[model samples]
Target chain A: MSITAPQGFVAAGVTAGLKPSGRADVALVRNLGPSMSAAAVFTSNRVFAAPVKWSRQAVADGQLQAVILNSGGANACTGPEGFADSAATASRVADRLGLITDNVAVCSTGLIGVRLPMDLLLAGVDDAAASLAPDGGPDAARAIMTTDTVPKEAVAEGAGWSIGGMAKGAGMLAPGLATMLVVLTTDAELPADALQGALREATRLSFDRADSDGCMSTNDTVILMSSGASGVTPGVAEFTASLTALCQDLARHLIADAEGAAHEIAIEVTGAASERDAELVGREIARSNLFKCAIFGGDPNWGRVLSAIGVTDAAFDADDLDVSFNGVMVCRAGQIGEPRDLVDLSGRHVRVTVDLHAGDRSATILTNDLTYDYVKENAEYST
Target chain B: MSITAPQGFVAAGVTAGLKPSGRADVALVRNLGPSMSAAAVFTSNRVFAAPVKWSRQAVADGQLQAVILNSGGANACTGPEGFADSAATASRVADRLGLITDNVAVCSTGLIGVRLPMDLLLAGVDDAAASLAPDGGPDAARAIMTTDTVPKEAVAEGAGWSIGGMAKGAGMLAPGLATMLVVLTTDAELPADALQGALREATRLSFDRADSDGCMSTNDTVILMSSGASGVTPGVAEFTASLTALCQDLARHLIADAEGAAHEIAIEVTGAASERDAELVGREIARSNLFKCAIFGGDPNWGRVLSAIGVTDAAFDADDLDVSFNGVMVCRAGQIGEPRDLVDLSGRHVRVTVDLHAGDRSATILTNDLTYDYVKENAEYST
Candidate 1:
């Protein structure tokens, strides 16, 4: 019970013969309610998949009756024909559901610069929309995976309404956004604008803070749909907080399942002049290959952390910085303080704290280490 | 003969008990000159080593009598005491050579936030100064290494004089200026300003373009010394070209010796609006961990190349980009073209060509594939 965990929503996952494994490769979620509204965020990359182009326009109407997703080919860099394929896909989904094309959103994930298996894909849309069920969210989540080993799903209950979501991604997951595909559903009474506001605030602190591989994807998209079935009109702050907490949970799920990652690092940056400084410092350290490699080796190399932050424009004095790995203060006041060997890293969860010693704002960035298996998985991804 | 391949430089490498391996960890280079003109560059990282701070000031007068470099400790983030250690080391070298402390530059590399073994270091300075010889460049080259497997040395000759140089750096080689220490000796009758201009242009094309691991070090320092012993007033063009070629040779050496690297990747971004665009695009691809990992697996994942450039502000239409892995042209006009398997990465050399088709300028960036040994070395480095 993923997306179906919420009321007034039905979903289905079906085999499209698009993937070489012939696994379930198509997913659909439909709104069945008195009110239909949605908001979405797509990849910031200028080069995106065909469905991203189509869905971006479809969501502009502030309401969506259905969302159709396929995982096999990215349909990115495929010229004008790719966009035509996506539009045809939305039209086909609309034909089966008896709705206009603008009320349908579309997304795709997989290899870039290749055309989708359109024949099998269009047929799967009809098969999927026909089989929509309230309990099909987990299957829908599984259908959208490329390299992910498991499906990701979460839920957050509000006063009388609830939010449920499912996501699929494992690589190219730096989230400017990642090649991530996500759909969240709620039965709360909210307009598209309100949903959009909540979604932006939630993602900014959740998915946006994850810097898994420092590589932004071309097919990232996250959607939020509301049906107003429960008729609970929660305040903006109340709704946004719950959504943010839910997204943070999903973000942790993403990192825990990240490809080739042996350790999940929580880099919390504290004492910054502004929130941006803290986030920038955290991202700078998270993206350092040397630091990641050191973590993979289970060595507490605080110098790599300091060197990583030294390149950023964050407000911090070099002499006033402090670093702690695990629970040991290996570096304090900018100098070696404790024996690095005293800090153990045998556990999968590692926390590194970088104290800017400047102000009060802080931020956390989630990432994984640079490992041999990560190299192997990605090297053989397309092969 | 490395730096001493020129006419008026003496050098030596001696063990100082700074390294546990008992290897030579101290290096000294002296300019026995008719004219004592010199120019140098330091790391752009604000959080730099004490030696970088001392050397930046020592070379401000455009003259340096000698340069003392040590391995095994960076002496960074060690507070006022670290600066004192650098100053003391410089003063001791000045006493041995009978030069002002202000004219003696010092450099240190290795673990950051730790102080150098000052007692052992000062004694090694005396030993190095006593053994300085006209043909001691190779020993000096070997002494400055931290994790490097081999010494990097290069020489290029002008009409009547020659320029010779040595460098040491492997990890953290993305220079905010080349994150390495270098010493160049030339016997031409050139002014300090002339040498500075030549060094900048040469390094901008050479070491500055090699972004190994995309990590910037705090101890990067490059010093150029001119004895003017040959009295050769070569034209600026002749000297600049020779210097650029020699620096390029050293840059290749650095990439080849990069830690945990198996294949060397030359990312050439062509048809850009400006040289800066070309460089930015090249670096965007070269710094990609996914792309580097893909290269290590001998898989031609040209999609990773396209995605890397998509995140940059370089001038390029997504539809017109073309990518080739070693000449197979896997992507043409932004769509799938030749089969990815047609590209062979069986050798140690791999070249990726991305044609923006946006303009006339182009640039090449040198990097290495991410490998297991790289992760192993960095993980165990501090231990």
Candidate 2:
């Protein structure tokens, strides 16, 4: 049971030679329910992809019957032709599924600015539609990967219902959906507005804090579709919690598979004036190449951590800050406290706690340490 | 003849036990001028080091008699005790030179948060002052390096006057002076206000455009001094051009010798709505790890270029942009223009040009590709 764990969803992934490796590069997810309720979040970058532009408009009505996702070529910066290609892809999906084009959402991820091989992409769409099955969720998850080392999926079981999700993408991932195509299916009887609220709230705490490289993608999208197949109406708050938990799981998965990352860093910024201030501080540390490299090298260079904090507007006294690496307090009252040797980072997971000592608000952000493999993979990614 | 090439200046470097390698770690530059005029710019980071806080105040009156610099200790996030270390270092230097401490500036680099060995530092100040020589510029330059592979020095000759400078720092360098220390000496008879204005103007085009790694340093500083020994007061524009040229030369040197850099990238952003917009675009591109890695791999991935542009506030029509790698126009009208293989990137230097098709404004930024050695050096730096 995967995305098909939900009662009314069918998904498929197919290969149409779009990828040189002949890997599955096309995926489709359809919600055949009494009601089609959905919510989606896209990249905030102004120079977005053609698929993003089209999906933004298509997702406006808060209803979606199906979503078509493709890898191998991101239809971004392809000008009007890219937009036309995405439109044609959606129209073809709608025609195959006997649904209107407006009810079909599209997502594409790969090298940007190159036109999709229209002939192959259109053919792949038909194959994806014909192969749709409840157990095709894993294939769909694998289809939209660009540089991801593995497929990512999450499931949360509720009373007589469940939420299933599939995601693809690893680096170049940040807030505002960052990078990737995430499709979640839930059979619970929740309203569209409720799904939107739950998604935003969940993602704000989950995916929004997953800042791997501080690079935001042009084609990032996260969509959730409700089929109401369970016939079990749950409180929006309960659903939101379950949904957030599932999203958080997938978010962590992305960090684990991040490019060239030797360590997964979880920075917890406590005692900020506000949540935004906490986020800003944590993100500054997450994005610091100095700190990231220190983590990669297994050095508890807390000075780089403190310096990264000093560059932000977060409310923290230079003389009163506290920093802990792993579980040892390396800095106390803004001065070196314990010997850095007391702390250990010889593991894949490293946690740094920075207490701003300003207020009670706090935020936790996840990032990956800079590594040699990340450089190798990205340097020759499109070659 | 670097710092001391200009008349009325003497420089010295001395060994201090601060660095484990026992390399020279203390440098002093003195002004023996008929007109003692000086100006300095410091990192705008909120968490600046003790020396930055001290020098910002000392140089405020624009009458610096000397600057004492040290490596192996950043003296950042060490709180009030750190500030005292900077103050005591200045006082010791001033006492030996028979001058007030307020007339002396200070700069420090290396591992942050560690208090400088005050005993070693103070003793080294005396040694540096006693050994002051007119030809000690190269030694002074070498004393302040951390991970730099070579010393960065530049000279520009003018009519009856010359400007000479030395710089240290690589990586974690960006605007607001990046993470570097620069000392520029001139024999021109310029007033403090003129020196300040000229320094700002020159740095706006030179040091400010060197955006390597996009990490701001708490100890970053660039100082300019006029000794009036040559007795020639060139026009402000001429002095600005000469100083800017010298700084630009050192800036290029910094990029060329940047740690773990396989390619030197000169990103030129043209057709922007404003110069600020152009700079924003260029800097965004310079900071993108994905884009930098592509350059390191010798991949002419212009799509990564567009993604970087999309994340900035720079005014540009996504549909009308053009990009060139090396000399090949890989993207035109925001679509694939030429085959990426048509371009070559085997050389040490590479250029990426972005045509926004928005307006006439343009700006250029210098950067280096993300390399494994960068990861290796930076990862193991603090360890």
Candidate 3:
């Protein structure tokens, strides 16, 4: 289920003095390529990290040979010096690998507005590039994590094609393009345009629907690189389906590790006029503090859900809306439907369904409940 | 100040067995008018309470004599039967006072999605109508409170003109058009159009900037009634000034009594491209859970503030932004500015200022921080 499962790809992760705990802090992935066609998606936040700026430009020509990531300092808002540090790190990796600097992408996640320890980061990049191996994907996954409770890695394999990805984020995780730092590798020989098109389409349903908190990050980057060394080119239809499944698996892992999360809740909005409408309604309900707290306390307070949905522009009659929580019909046609018991909420998963009764288009958003530990963890986070 | 400080109005509050606690649950206010003209603003929430629907229809003709309010239950989503209940309440009050049913306005605040206790509610309405008095404003204010630690009332006097108001809301509070049930009474000889114009202008700067928990209610209503019992008419300039001061006072009281709120934080956004931009930035910062929790923990985490503002479309560079928390310059031009100990945030007031470095337009939003008690209180909230 790791990136090594992808054909003609090798990955490695190691510690090079970036974090004091000696956990993996540097990860490298290489595409043993006959063709280097690739694509990437990054955060839309205007205040982006230096690594994001470099990777965004690197993917402009739609080709990539490798990706290097670290998880100790974001190197964001550190001025011109931070940008130079990111470029220098990429250059050092390219020099050691005898590859073009523009063909390498970089990502960093951790504290913001702090200068990266260049001496340590550059040395880490060299060590990571040297340690790259076909079975190093798990180590690479462990290296690109900050506050994530577990490493997130997913893989989808078929007869002639393979898809694999690793993601790391627990907070500041809302979507414009993607939520956090992610690297996806594949071996199917696909055009650059096709890869980019498939990445965007896959993210719209997967990473885009995982909202832990409403904060969007400044360093969210998702890179998809194709080695094209396996001599297998699946049809676009199968490639897209595999990509969707892979992204969904990765998104589920992200939510399961959301910071201080209690129950992982799935909010489904059905019978909306359009997919966009359904997403809007689902996300709105997912982000409501009242609804989240109710889930935390195990109360079937359907009024809060209806009120949250009613505020959105999604077309639906309040009287025609129906809501269910954990298989209990709490509200029907906007009125209290059936009386349900408020019992233990200790389970790790919960489900909420909303029937908009407008159209067939629907969307599902994943979120976590608000709990006391969530408030405590974030309240003193900066200290 | 209570509503009775205003000239030419009678108010009363009574208990008629609606609430199990036997507290004041019904209130009545009447204008002994030589002229009767009014204007009102209703909640933008599509699923509104029955009283909101009735008042919206009643105020269409721009004339009103009385307002009947109950605080034990919000008759929302009770279907056609709910509308019938609202009309019957108005009819009972109108019959007692020999006034037209259309001249009476109704407002209710409490739990949503439950039908009004018809027998108790009707009895309370009749009792409140009979107990109406010229000096019962304080009683009326006390009656329309649910989970509020204190009652909110404000009064302002002009040269022969006067204005007063009462508000009730402890949660489900946020910006647009105010997030609670409010009734403003004025004795100035003014038409409905002038009252509407002034009310909108005042609310934009006052009630519209208050955010308790970022949840907009399903029963928000702000009504302004002109008894015109006093023959003197203030000029537009003077009337607006008085209205602004009155609203400001009421807004302060509302924030002071916000449920489970320990501190009142004022977020000011200055040097924006436009007033709208300033308000947008201020509200964004105010509603950020991270920022609110930081204040609660007494940590001056200015990075959260910068990141929150950075996500908006406001025309300001991160490096050009300056932020101060509780008089400490924590960030300058998006970078860490000054080194100071985090101020004590255990007090009842907190302030955050953001300098956008764009223009002179500015705005301020008042809000309360997220605390443990807030979650506990809201988690147990049910009908």
Candidate 4:
């Protein structure tokens, strides 16, 4: 049911008093392993948080033993002091675990440019390390949440291994991984190179394709660790598939929890010249304000859909394209295929499919409809 | 005054019943040309309206005598029949004026799909021609408006000639000249190539940089015509400067009238490696929903600005970037420069300045804040 369901991993979550609501704001997970190999992917945004800078550098070693995460302060855009605070937090965790500081990773999320509550975070790290348990995954999941309606965690069992993860993101989400911050753990025996390769591929189709608001975050990151405690050593292909599924499930959960979203929309682009082209078209539609607003209003405005794709450089003539909304053929061969009154959109789930007529390559992107609440929530968020 | 406030032109606006409200929905303007040279621009969107296709081809002849415009039903995506309607409308206008059909351009805006009410449009075209007057600019301005709160018209008087224009756009606005439809008329004599060159140069910095909602339209266009009826041939250099100022003025009006917008935000990006880089950075910040929402709520959340720019490919280290919101230094060298409580955004205008520290190039983009009404208006727009 939780990320710690995997073997050889102990985790704990605790309150650091950083959040005014007294919610859990600090989490720790350690790999009690015969071997510790890990890989990580970070936000492509040139502007990065202090913690992200540290974690990215540490992962260059291709191995990690533990990760320390905190919420309520992103420790981003806080200058030299922010980097020192992140390093100090990681050092405190490593010191408590009697491990080398270089073997630990750090991640922080929440409001950007606010100083980390050093006194509270340092104490919370100690508490989390002492309380670490095999069944502490749920608590860890709860600690890394900010404006999320619910805790997102998923586990998938395989023939001999299992994949599990926890994620926290609701806004500032778009391509280049959005504001996603995820941690995945598995008991499979895999090298760091293999894990990195699998993560890049899986994320490209999962988190990288989930564009909720089209705002990339400076703190987006995903780290994967293998404890090698299960001794399963499954084939790389099977492990990769399980990892991909886990990521997809977590992505779905993230989309469902998108801030102020009323409906989860899936935009599918088929018959593109390449998978990249299909993804480009699909993402363009997903990020379109007009398309999203129409979805929110429960209007099957297929003209807006086709118009969104029309601006892209994809090799498809307008007349050669076919668009369907929720199984209704709203447009065919670039012409209005159905009356606007014919399509019913009062439901929660909406599916839009676009056929490019170029090649067999296709892609699907998960997004949320732009709603009144989305504007209200985000507009009032900083205030 | 209106687009024909310039000396050598006459215009008219008439009710055609194209809109159920029985408002003026048809307009006509003619260049009383002793020298009939013109320049025009069309939407870059591949899924263009039928009128756009016709106008592009008609303008290819390097000479234009008149333009006919209608609102309430954009003849877009109606297939071959839509093309026929566009031709028919142009033909009707040519017949009334006794000019070649190829010399008369056409433009249509409003809801997509539904065919034009040919009976109403044809009759209204005749009325517009009959009622054409040198001072009928205001009527023509009113006829070409759809969902616009008011008619947009401006006039600039020079030494011996004048420049006047009208525009209509309230939403679906973004980089590729937004969803705006503009008609500019000048009395000074100039060749079509010079007009075309000036139009392109002015639009590059004016219309192309007005990003209110980041939704490019299928019917965006701007047409510039010279009557040469004044016989006052200003130097090309002076004429181009006047035209550029006119475009900037109109672009500002368009941004001011963006749908449901409560505030106009100006984003300036400086010290980029190239003008393109600066524009890219400025556009990224301008189109950020989170940043726009923050400004809407009067919250000076500066981190959103930095993160938005960081996602671009511009060459600037995060640590070397600085951001200011509404004259308050919120970020310095990619770090928090001022307390959130210190920045005040309780005004109808917001200004954001970003310094990349990479080079000397700079650019500015005008946008409007994302508000609840914006969502409401766009969601129910078509329905």
Cα deviation at A47, candidate 2, in Å, is: 2.0
**Where does model 2 exceed 4 Å of error?**
none
| Per-candidate interface DockQ score | 0.78, 0.77, 0.62, 0.84
Tens-digit lDDT string for candidate 3 (B1-383):
46666777889999977777788989888877877898888888777778999999999999888899998888887778888999999998899888999999999887777888989888888888888888899999999988887889988899997998999888878877456788899889999999988988888888899888777777888888888877888997899889988888888888888877778999999999999999989988877777777787887777668767877899798778888888877777777677637555668899899999999999999998877777777777753
CA lDDT scores, all candidates in order: 0.90, 0.89, 0.84, 0.88
Candidate 3 clashes between residue pairs 3 or more apart in a chain or in different chains: none
For residues B192-284, write the lDDT of model 4, one tens digit per residue. Answer: 999999889888888899999988888888999998767888888788888888888888888888898999989999999999999999999
lDDT of each residue in A257-289, candidate 2, tens digit only: 988788999999999899999999999899888
- Write down the worst ten-residue block by lDDT for model 2 chain B: B170-179
**What value does the TM-score of chain B take for model 2?**
0.99
Cα error, residue A239 of model 2, in Å, equals 2.0
User: Looking at candidate 2, what is the lDDT of residue B313?
Assistant: 77
Indicate whether candidate 1 or candidate 4 has the larger lDDT.
1
Error of 3 at B175 (Å): 1.9
* Model 4 chain A: lowest-lDDT 10 consecutive positions: A374-383
Clashing pairs in 1: A175-A178, B260-B374
**What are the TM-scores, per candidate, against the unseen true structure?**
0.98, 0.97, 0.96, 0.99
Clashing pairs in 2: A260-A374, A379-B293, B174-B178
Stretches of candidate 1 exceeding 4 Å from the true structure = none
DockQ of 2: 0.77
